[model samples]
Target: MLTWIALTALLLFSLATYMAGRRRAVAVTAGKPAQLHSLPGYYGSYAALWAGVPAALLILLFAMFGGRLEAGLLRVDPPAAVQELTAPQQDVFYDDARAIARGGTPSETIYDGALKTALEDKAAKSQQISSLIQYGSIGLGAILALAGVFIAYPRISPQFRARNKVEGWVAGLFVVCSVTAILTTAGIIASLVWESWRFFQAVPVHEFLLGTEWNPQIAMRADQFAGAGAFGAVPLFVGTFLIMLIAMMVAAPIGLFSAIYLSEYASPWTRSVVKPLLEILAGVPTVVYGFFAALTVGPLFRSFFNWIGAQLAGGSFDGLAQYLMQVQNQMALVAGAVMGIMLIPFVSSLSDDIINAVPQSLRDGSLAMGATRSETVKKVVLPAALPGIMAALLLAVSRAVGETMIVTMAAGLQARMTLNPLDTVTTVTVQIVTLLTGDQEFDSPKTLSAFGLGLTLFAVTLMLNIVALRIVRKYREQYD
Candidate 1:
């Protein structure tokens, strides 16, 4: 609340500084705007940026790190009662004190006697330290903002080059944003590698990569009845690809053909209507798709297959009939079909844009050679759009590989290595969610295995992207 008030005050101050700078610029030029090197608004914006940027940076820094600094200062000199507790207990004690200071609820552990007294004393100290940091930072930020106004407002003259300075600041802000994104990606990859390395220390890399089973629930103690965990990731990889293949089988052709028709055969009115209706499927939530899969498509497919099985029950295909009869609502086929329906918009939208991007001159030239519309589309437009179509398919494959909710709801979480789409299966993403769903100890192989799975998925996705990029580049050269 204090920070928000400070921010609001700083905003108002910056606005005031902007007006002062603009007025000063016009006054220095004898109220003749033509005499200024840049517009009066540029001088105002320059002053506003200087007043806001430094102070905003200070506020952001304090907001991000103030609590940690407060905690560190509080822990520098602990109470005797807190010193007597174990490390974890001391952490809890500090947490309780901080919570009390902030008027928030702490842990359920009831405190009494010396510990309770110590908590109260520490809470008071914490509150004092927190206020000191908050007020001190706000005060320092106000001083910096005032300093910026003094430094910038006096420089508002005819030859001040305010626009160039403002552009430089904007350029620096863009550079900062680009660096932040790169650093964020680097941090994610590094954390995944470090945690996956720890998991590999407990579970052999070869076993995780090649072994067939994937039960990750290990017994917590020696005498427990639970079996030792199996960490084979082959089943996960198989199921992931099996479902991906099935989804692509349903998505690729349909989405591509839809794009082709929309771009080539459909009239403008038809395209306008059908395009958004198809793209509407993209905006639907994945959870909703999951529910649709579970409630509607799964049962519909099961009934249709069961009817087929009944027809073949007493025939020569009795064995096949029994297998088909046993098929459940939750299977790879249902999930893949639903996921494909979900991906149709992604492929269709991107491919439609790509196909339309092909030069009209190519189609005209093909027609000038007496080729039919279909022949022109097959030979000229499709070849020109092939690279972008491949990219769109790659994007769809990535979506399918990363999907979880639909697979979780429609496909039962059974980690079995089978290509049969009729069987229940699970994907790596679903297992990752399962492994880390509840409170989990990071030291345990079961929890750390999520990172291992994530790393593997990341590697596969990267390799697929590399391959796709190479294919795209190769085709692009020919087309260009």
Candidate 2:
């Protein structure tokens, strides 16, 4: 609360400095605006950035690290009661103190005797320390903001290049954002690698990659009946690709054809009306798609298959009929079909834009050469837009591969290696969710296996991106 108040005060001060700086620029120019190196707004923005950025950084820094600082200070001289407790108990003690200091309820564990006394004492001290940190940070931020104003307000003269300085600051901000993104990606890859390494220490990588069984449940004791866990990932990979293939089979032609019609054939008014209506499918929540698959599409497909099976019961196709009649609600077909519906807008919108971006001169030239509209579209437009179309398809593939809710709801969580779309199967993402759902011990292979799966999925997605990028680049060069 105090940090927010300080930030608000600093923002108002920055606005005031902006107005003052603009006026100063005009004043220094002796009422001649053209004498200034940059516009009055640039001068104002320069002063505002100076007045806000430093103090905002300080406040944000305090907000990020103040708790850790407070905890370090509190733990410098521990109570005898706190020191007597176990490591976990000591953690709980501090947690309870912090919660009590913040006027929130602590854990259910009742504190009694010296522990209770220590908790109350520590809570009071924690409150005092928190107040001190908050007040100190706000005061320092105010000082820095004032200092910034004093330093920047004097430099708003006509000869000063305020525009260049402001742009430099903007460039620095962009660099910081880029560096932050790179660092974040590095951090994620590092964590995945580390955890996967730990998992491989428990289970060999060859077995995880090549072994057929994927039972990750390990026995609690050495003598328990449940055999050692299997961590074969091939079934998961098969299921993931099977669903992705099914989804692409459904989505690719329909979405591409829709894009072609909208871009080339539809009138402007029709395009405007139908495009948004089609894109609305993109905005529909995946959970809703899952529900549609579970309640509507699954039952419909099942009944249709069952009806066909019943019709063929007395014929030569009786064996195939039995298989069709036994089909369940939860199958790869249900999840993939619904997921394809979800991806149509993504493919159509991107492909439509790409198709429209093909030069009108190409179409005109082809028409002048006696080619029909469809022939022009096929030979000229599609080839020109092929790279972008490939990119769109890759994005849709990524979306399909990463989907979990639709798969979990519509497709059963059985990691079986099968080519038939009617069979129940689970993907890598679904199993990752299942493995990490509840309270899990990270030391165990089951929990750590999630990271291994994540690493493998990341690798496969990266490879796909690389292959797609190469294809896009090859076609793009030809077209260009």
Candidate 3:
């Protein structure tokens, strides 16, 4: 509230300063604005910058100090009962006081009068500090604006370069944006690496990277029946790759063929109708696909497999009946197939664009040499678009690897090492979600394992992108 109020007051004062600065500039020009150094709007904007920047900095300073001030004020001397808490419990007490001061119930076991009196004192101190900061910032801005007007009014001749200064600030803003993006990426990587390092300290890196088992249940008490958590990530990666492979298998050929038809074979009206209808599949939520996979596709596949199994069971291939019966409502194939459907638009749209980008002269040349349309597409256009198509496929693979909801609903959360697409499997994303779902302690390896999984997923996706880049660059040289 204080921050917002300060900013609003600062903005209003800046507007007033802008008006005054523009009026002063015109007055300096003896009512002939054309003789002024820069445009009236530029002068006004410069004055507004002088009026707001100092005040904005002050407001930011206050916000940076506000949290520590509030926490210190609330935590000082506390109540008798809260002061008697253990170190950890005292942290909780301060948290409770902060919550209560913010209109929540007090969780500390203290007297009501003491709690009320402390909260009231905290509120009074907060108000006093906020008002002081707010008014002081506004006053500072007023002084700065007045000083700027005195200093700048005489300098408003034709030689002044207000536009250059403003453009410099604009360039600074761009630099700030670029730095912010770099910092954000660095922060994410740091957090992931830090937590993953902690997890690896508790669970061996080899065990996590190479072990096939992925049970992550940790027993809380000594008498608990759970074994030490197995942090093996192999099954997760394998399952992820299996499902991704299946998804790509289903999506690549189908999406590529669809793109080919739309780009090469389909007439204008046909392409217009079919392209959007096909792309609509991408707009459907993954959860909807999850439901479709689990409720519809899984059962259909199982039933169809069972019928096949039954037919073959009465013959020498009776051993397949047991395997076919294992096909259930949740499996990698179902999730993969649905995920493929979901990714069709990504592939089709990219491939279509890439195919369309192929030079028409190449196709014409092929046709002029007596090649058919299909042969021209296969021999000329496809090779030219191959790099782009490969990029699209890898992009789809990355999407498949990162998918969560569809795998959760259509593929069971059992990490198993098997080639059976009909069997249930789990992926890194699914386990990451499972590991972090409840009130799990961050210090526990079970909880920190999510960060580990995230790091692994990041590495895999990064490697894929690198490979795709190499392929694109390699083929680009050949074609370009």
Q: Largest TM-score belongs to which candidate?
A: 1
Where is model 1 more than 4 Å wrong at Cα?
76-121, 218-229, 469-480
248-293, model 3: which lDDT tens digit per residue?
A: 9889998999999999999999999988897787788888888899
Clashes of 1: 0
Off by over 4 Å in 3: 31-37, 73-104, 111-127, 134-155, 222-229, 473-480
Lowest summed lDDT window (length 10), candidate 3 = 221-230
Per lDDT, the best of the predicted structures is: 1
The order of the candidates by lDDT, greatest first, is 1, 2, 3
lDDT of each: 0.91, 0.89, 0.81
For model 2, the run of ten residues with the poorest summed lDDT: 219-228
Q: Report how far residue 37 has shifted in candidate 3, in Å.
A: 5.1
Clashing pairs for model 2 are none
Task: Give residue 320's error in model 1 in angstroms.
Answer: 1.3
Cα error, candidate 1, residue 173 (Å)? 2.2
Better of 1 and 2 by lDDT: 1
lDDT of 2 by residue, 1-480 (tens): 778888999999999989988998999899998999999988998888888989999999989999988887877788887899999998888989999999999999888999999999999999999889888888888888889888999898989999999999999989999999999999999999999999888888998898778778854654443234479988998999999999998899999999999999999999999999998888899999989999999999999998999999979999999999999998999999999888888889989988987889999999999999999999989988988899889978988888888998888889898979999999999999999987766688888899999999998788777877786667657646
